[model samples]
Target: MQKVDILAIGAHPDDVELGCGGTIAKMIAAGKTVAIVDLTRGELGTRGTDLTRAEEAAKASEILKVSARENLEMKDGFLQNSEEYQLKIVKMIRKYQPTIVFSNAIDDRHPDHAKAHKLVSDACFLAGLPKIETVLDGQPQTAWRPKQIFSYIQWKNITPDFVVDISGFIDKKIEACLAYKTQFYDPGSKEPMTPIATKDFLESLTYRAQDLGRLSGVEFAEGFTTEKLLAFKNFDGIVL
Candidate 1:
């Protein structure tokens, strides 16, 4: 039972990369143990097969240097915030026992993204209840809850509650995103063009980070939203 410092959950294979890869890269560089848990295999994606997505996800995880990556095998386009689904997420939370969790955006163009947000957020709360028993590997799991849970921005420009300075790690984020070659911009590929496969979409990754950075007074940054209020112990804890 290896405990991780953070767990990032997404609706599909590349959602984590698209949403918060830079933040993950920055945290990993700071020696924090991070893991990724994708809710689906992305079998319904138009550009690539499940097998290709898995391969690409593995490559991206390698680039990000995540401690572990797991897919929950949930239905790709039909994500549900049901108890069964919530329990599955609770199991992972209990297993990892992460102090912080990053989930998909609360609202996005893709319906699955919002659904995943609710599922992960609800599970995070339910996981801490001792009455909600769960078992993994033939053993009973203990109740656990993360200290913080934040939602990353995606597709939509929902205002962020706070931003993380990822000045030096944006390149790593792009590199990891490009690892999903079958899903992103590629002029040579015969695959049908999707919104995410466009050249502008590829460029948006950098420009979006830059825009967030401009507002935050950093070279590059990533935005996140949280339901609970965030507090700092001292003035020095914040970047000016």
Candidate 2:
């Protein structure tokens, strides 16, 4: 029943934060509504438990100012681009009726990330199909599809189709990311360490934004890839 201007779907708890937190912050700061759908609790992650991830996710969502956030509770690391999974995501897409949807990169080192990309992309397309009925809270849901689907970049160095300028939002993005207390570096925590979700990882998040910003001539930015080519309606967009 919640309305949102944009909906970002991720394969795991922190993927959205790592991938598009700055963009999301920019959107929210501009008064555009936003939401997040975490496909899984990241139970299979190397560092945190499901309960801990959920709590951290909540904190991050609050910092992001998203209108809504939900976890599909799907199996982590074992997702499949199947009809059943697609239907579940479709249901959410219709329920939220977001105007723009952001999903994971189509190809990634994480098999689950690729699967999530396919699932969300298919669901976004199918959400517009009038015949594919979806129900929510015992009532039939109306068909709706997002106008645009942007895939956020991940671990891979795939060339981005475009980048979002997050110059003023770098701090906000980091704040949201640190909400995942158990995932990132906490010098005081006794939890085991991992390659990602560490202090160095957190530092990289900032520098990554700086790197992308330099390429786009912005103070900070986030990169994204698109399934189809990007287009602008006017010649002004072509101006230097």
Candidate 3:
């Protein structure tokens, strides 16, 4: 099993790219190993087939240079908080054994996003129970729980608990996001326009980061909310 420092889980393929790709890029650049898990292949999307989405996800993973990327193939619009779904995530948590998990937003415009947030949050807690019993690759997997779970902001202006200064990596994030050509704003394509495909949404990616940065004293940044209170080892990590 490939151990990583961080595991980012999303409801759909480009969710991570749109939400925390800059943060992921910055962390990986700092030598932190990171993996991505898409809960769904986004088969119900207005544009792009499942194959196309999978291909785009692969390209986005390459752009971010993540250690690994996997899809759970969950139902696109209907996410459940059932044990079966929880165990699937448990297997991944055990397989990667990451300390930090980045999950979907607590609340968002998309119903699936909120559902995913609770599902992943519960799985993280359940993964720590020894009796859960998970097996990977025909071998019994040990129980593992992440130290922290942070929910990335998406499709809403929810207040953030903290923000990561992703100034230098915003371009990398945008590149990864645009990798899903069928999903985002593409003027040349004749596909039907969705909320995200609008030109305004494309520009919002940058302006939103800049706005968050403006509030937090950075050139650009990504915001996340945590269920647990965050503690700092020292003030040295804080940017002035």
**The candidate that achieves the highest lDDT relative to the unseen native structure:** 3
lDDT of 2 at 212: 84
The digit string of per-residue lDDT tens for model 2 on 48-120 reads 7999999999999989888889999999989988888999999899988998899998788899988898899
The digit string of per-residue lDDT tens for model 1 on 10-68 reads: 99999999999999999999999999999999999999899999999999999999999
Q: Which pairs of residues have clashing backbones in candidate 1?
A: none
In model 1, the runs with Cα more than 4 Å from the true position are none
lDDT of each: 0.95, 0.88, 0.96
CA RMSD of each candidate after superposition: 0.7, 1.6, 0.5
Candidate 2 lDDT score at position 220:
83
Candidates arranged by TM-score, highest first: 3, 1, 2
Least accurate stretch of 10 residues (summed lDDT) in model 1? 231-240
Whole-structure CA lDDT of model 3: 0.96
The parts of candidate 2 lying over 4 Å away from their true place are 235-239
lDDT score, candidate 2, position 207: 90
| Error in Å for residue 233 of model 2 | 2.2
Clashes of each: 0, 0, 0
Q: Pick out the ten consecutive residues of candidate 2 with the lowest summed lDDT.
A: 231-240
TM-score of structure candidate 1: 0.99
